[model samples]
Target: MSHRTVNFKGNPVPLEGPELKPGDTAPNFRLQQNAADGLGDATLDDFAGKTLLISVVPSLDTSVCAQQTRTFNQKAAQLPDNVAVLTVSMDLPFAQARFCGTEHIDRIKVLSDHRTADFGRAYGLLIAEGPLQRILARAVFVVGPDRKIKYVEYVPEITQEPNYDAALAAVA
Candidate 1:
């Protein structure tokens, strides 16, 4: 079946099956992030040689986004130390940091896409047209230590949560 097309905020976007698979090389991505230390930038290489749980959320301020991040953070704590849980969102770095602080979230790393929506666009998470214009849809991708996509979950609703169990199992 063909994937869905939707606009987020205002940008046009297409949701497509990943071009890279579990055995295929995961695509490289550079992202802006908010850390406890401060604003920083990261790339796919940063998570190389380790399992990666990439939880893509629309915005950290939203209810679904908050729940998604919380769930991932909880799960990340249970995973091996070498595994990294990275939550990517379109929220500003400052906003992300505030959300983490408000929620007392520490297990997962929150990455921002405010400077450039490159990671969202590259992963086909950016919605094309909608009230959430420029924001991403809820999606999850699990990458193995070798940087291959081991699992993928793209929520049908813009406000729904991804299948945490399946995504987590892929990492396990």
Candidate 2:
């Protein structure tokens, strides 16, 4: 399904929360893995003392989102061992697992926000209206080993890819 149409090549949309910036502390999140019961098995504290890259996307079923995840999976392998990457989306866990299995996405952890949209709202990347309403706007956050955000990029265009170089640099 189309995440964004050609007509909406680049349009501003309403978002839900405060836009996080560098030096801001990354919020602790407990995201769901294989269930939609509104509970999470993975928490931010799980990666304590490690650099974390949170890649937020609308839906993995879409082309841009899929490519973004795949790109990060490749990039993750080259990152420092202390760095952990996560791809968050509203897609159900089943679909996410299937996508990872088919695409050989083994490096980063792919989690679902369909449970509570907690991650989206907390990160201020939730599209509150438009065609992508209820979905997450593309964003990347790099949290340092101290859990402080070292970089933040809220991709202006919903349909476009994020700045991989900038995010990767922040991790370094």
Candidate 3:
């Protein structure tokens, strides 16, 4: 587990796994998605040969998390077609699908880590303990086509928004 800590409403909480840094290869992860056919698996390779902007959130039910997802959804339109934006959370696939439908989110892909916590553990965003136990911390990662991370932001405060401009600039 990583020694990293983040705040939630000014309360400090520990995080698991080593914090990822720039230049490091983005770890591969499998997330679940609710589809018309049924539940499906989405892996890092699904976006191979494209730049990936990953938005990590604890849950979409929260205001901050919803905003984060919506923001990236809008931003996805401006990015090149080869760039894929994904919103990952510990929420159940059913909840994620509902949120996207209710929020009218279409541009970005919403993935669930509830089943395995694979994304959370691999990315080091899992909140070890707190009221929001087992949830992910707010963070963002931009991985280039080659799979090397170009930008990373582990937001100090989970309630705040990530640096959208800086992350977008990295892709541009």
Q: Rate the local accuracy (lDDT) of all candidates.
A: 0.78, 0.85, 0.92
lDDT of 1: 0.78
Q: Cα miss at 77, model 2 (Å)?
A: 1.0
**Maximum-TM-score candidate:** 3
Model 2, CA-based lDDT: 0.85
lDDT of 3 by residue, 17-111 (tens): 87899999999999999999999999999998999999998889999999999999998999999999999999999999999999999999999
* TM-score of model 1 (CA atoms): 0.86
Which lDDT value does model 1 have at 54?
A: 90
Q: Where in model 1 is the C-alpha error above 4 Å?
A: 1-3, 6-22, 35-37
Candidate 2: regions farther than 4 A off: 1-8, 35-40
TM-score per candidate, chains pooled: 0.86, 0.90, 0.97
Q: Quick one: best lDDT, which candidate?
A: 3
For model 1, residues 77-165, the per-residue Cα lDDT tens digits are 78998899999998888888889999989988888877777777677776545355678778888888877788877776665678888
